[model samples]
Target: MTDKLLNHRAEGSTTAPPLLLGPSLGTSTVLWDTVAPELSATHRVVRWDLPGHGGSAADLIGPGATVGDLAVLVLALADALGIERFAYAGVSLGGAVGLHLAVHHPERVSALAAICSSAHFGGSQPWEKRAALVRREGLAGLAESANSRWFTPGFTVPELVADHRDADPGAYAACCDALAAFDLRDRLPDITVPTLLVAGREDPATPPAHLREIADAVPGSALVEIPGASHLAPAQCPQAVLIALRAHFSGGAKHGMEVRRQVLGDVHVDRAQARQTPFTARFQDFISRYAWGEIWTDPTLTRRERSMITLTALVAHGHYDELAMHVRAARRNGLTPEEIGAVLLQTAVYCGVPAANSAFATAQRVLAEEAEGTGG
Candidate 1:
């Protein structure tokens, strides 16, 4: 493992899960900036500049410096941060690293998310050829290729294209090599952690079929396609990506998005409330479309199960206001008192008695209010 790499961290509530994130090739933690706010609201999102990207050292070593090497580096980073176990999420090259960790060190990951990545990354000719160009000419040689793979047709920005072109060739080549060697086709069945495979409908690089293969291969893995988004789901459609990821990670996505919306409410409203600003008129769009449209529409899991997971997350993270609201929503969704009790009881062990106790009390209040209103 390289002894030096620049890791970027944004502090969210200390209560949420510690998510160790890995970035894509040639990009730093900046790739997560757009999506971090929504995620950080409920998770301690950790992103690092991989070996040759951002402020990290650009040392392209021998055979061992592969995606597996990056996975090892991330594990070491988690250890350094005192995170014994965490939920893992990554994109492209980063997703490949997450796969390695999930297969080799399952205990270290609580849940896993793979975005725009494949177990057997398609023909390595593209990446191999790019790596050679980087080695021979420099970062300038692989500019056009990176742009085509990274951005979709309509969304490609000239400045962003220029920036990628200007990135260090050595680092770019190193990442390409890692991508070229990544292959977990047979190992996906061994990953026990609950997994989420996200794809951009327009992602030409990995394509939807690649994500489908990952979902089918990984037991209990769920697949979600981000419409209109490219390989850079977080960057292209942050709201959609954020809702999908958070719903999956927090376990509220099972009952569909209506359950997620009821738990988190509208992101815009939640954001305004958190910041003590008045809710804007347009905030309703955030609730109707994102919180309800996408997530609530999926009907794979029961509302009761979704309630349990969402409540557990809220209690664990100490999101009291949302917890109270969800408690009411659970009741509206026909959750019984015993079920609510069970959720809180479970949280007592996973989160803590105090947080669970608070949730229970709020549940009682919400249930009582709901009963009285329904009776009226």
Candidate 2:
């Protein structure tokens, strides 16, 4: 039954690329509450809660559990969702699970982002001690110090702290066991998938050096360090985490999204995004990656020049609706009304009079709308 799977929340269009999100040891899926919604605009985001932490059953894990064990559960979750392959990003313990998946189950992972995670976790002594303490004393005392260990001064997530407080003691201790024996340093060089390592500079637990170590060991990996952030960077610096995730997961699409906003304007881009459906997700990605990222971003031509070329092409092809949209883009690109008219007139000589006349009618309506601030 689905109840046997890890507790997870899925968002975005089903046809969109799948992206699995993992939470830190003590956190629930709510750790991604702020960032996952926006990422769902392009990805089918599925964020899961760790065993004994959120909605998952405590018995899902035990004292001798390893990160690999957690990873297996993740694969089971993906299997239950009918996801054969997916991209992954995780924080802390979650990040370790992502790395395990990438290394041990490369065929299942398309890309990876390990945030505030490490290859060795500074050996197992400290985690062993912590686990022992949790086992003997329960989570009340440990949860009290969670904010200090997980966040920078003056910043905290009460929900996450409560999660720590409410977590099943045995499962939480078992997770500590997982962290205790975890060591991927030797396997770092084996990760061939695209990898991104993020570090919170102020994090005393798993600092920037830990992430840097993974970056150095992993071939062709990238690293980003966020200041003013601690172990839970996504919770404290969600926008920063979001930017890094977007860049890492969809390089061209990320840059293309920015260009799309600039060329088409926010209102227009937002409208297009709003109208995007499961059937249209792939097309939207193509427009962003190929149209905006590659072509429009080419340095060989300026925005103004590109706008002029686009107008001519639309007119030549008799794409009146697109011509109308580009007419507004031309204005935004710094083309004066007279300059646009001149371009349209030139199109008539090559594209024939009928097409140009129709283009003119469309452009006139767009120009009139722009004048009244009624449309783009």
Candidate 3:
């Protein structure tokens, strides 16, 4: 069930749903080598090299190639491979392409996973300058910038350095140009695909804020930040990334929606009823089946354990309201006072004392309510 299509090839389980994976800037399908084996164990993976970047072909669409154009090439590759509907995952530029496809051609993309990417890459003069350099002097001129953003100084290796050096200048420049003109900020609301955004905590280029913007812009998209990792999170933390991605696709919308509703409750439905917006009905449907049914239904962990982890995460992140509500739910999940205190103490060191203090205060208030209710 695996063969070369127009620009890509399929791998892994033939019976399982196919995953169309796109490469990052200046990388080839080979970039997925370290991670593909892990993903392919259960699902069919389709990895592709953008034109002029890898073994597929050396055709440069030039600096004028738009994100939309890259998306079209992806769709065509899927069509040529006879893949009607499949999950999509990409890194960096590849991630943006997945978003574009999910937005523009929803039916073709069953689910999405975007790593270290943004909805809008912005229009900065530095980007234009880099593109100009790549086009004129080739990828060599842009090597330092790419290296700085892609790898930590201490982790650089001979092979890794050579990989960047070996990249096709034309393809690198073309992708840089595409990114320069890419902007989907205003249109992010239209995306309905189940999406996951993964970013490195130490990533200087895309950063966690870029992932945060994506999560906020796309309703229901979950964001995961891996600590101690750089921009190459997929490579640095493949196991975590694959675990989340598989859970999303295999479980789909039904499970996640159910879990979300049980935890977040009818915040959506109540708001919908209050406003009666046209999207209200769909909103209710989405929460019930996807958030609650799929994600919550999984036996992976008890609702209580999940709640504790989620609350700890939000507290660590300084999302006060969300942290507060989850703190309340933690009691229902049977989280003990000591456990909550432990989470706070852990966050104090990693997430700052001020944030941990707020979380501890919120937890104390919720614990008092539990105590009073039991006493009454």
Per-residue lDDT of model 2, residues 256-313, tens digit only: 9999888889988999999999899879977997699778998999999999999999
lDDT of 3: 0.74
Q: Where does candidate 3 stray beyond 4 Å?
A: 1-6, 157-160, 252-376
Q: Which ten-residue region of model 1 has the weakest summed lDDT?
A: 252-261
Q: What is the lDDT of residue 258 in candidate 3?
A: 49
lDDT of each: 0.75, 0.92, 0.74
Better lDDT candidate (1, 3): 1
How accurate locally is residue 349 in candidate 2, as Cα lDDT from 0 to 100? 98
TM-score, model 3 to reference: 0.64
- What would the TM-scores of all predictions be? 0.68, 0.74, 0.64
Show model 1 residue runs off by greater than 4 Å: 60-64, 157-163, 252-376
Best-fitting candidate, measured by lDDT? 2
**Sliding window of 10 residues with minimal summed lDDT for model 3:** 1-10
For model 3, residues 130-188, the per-residue Cα lDDT tens digits are: 77786677766556566677766666434444556677777666777788888888888
Relative to the true structure, candidate 2 reaches a TM of 0.74
The list of candidate 2 runs beyond 4 A from truth reads 1-3, 254-358, 361-376
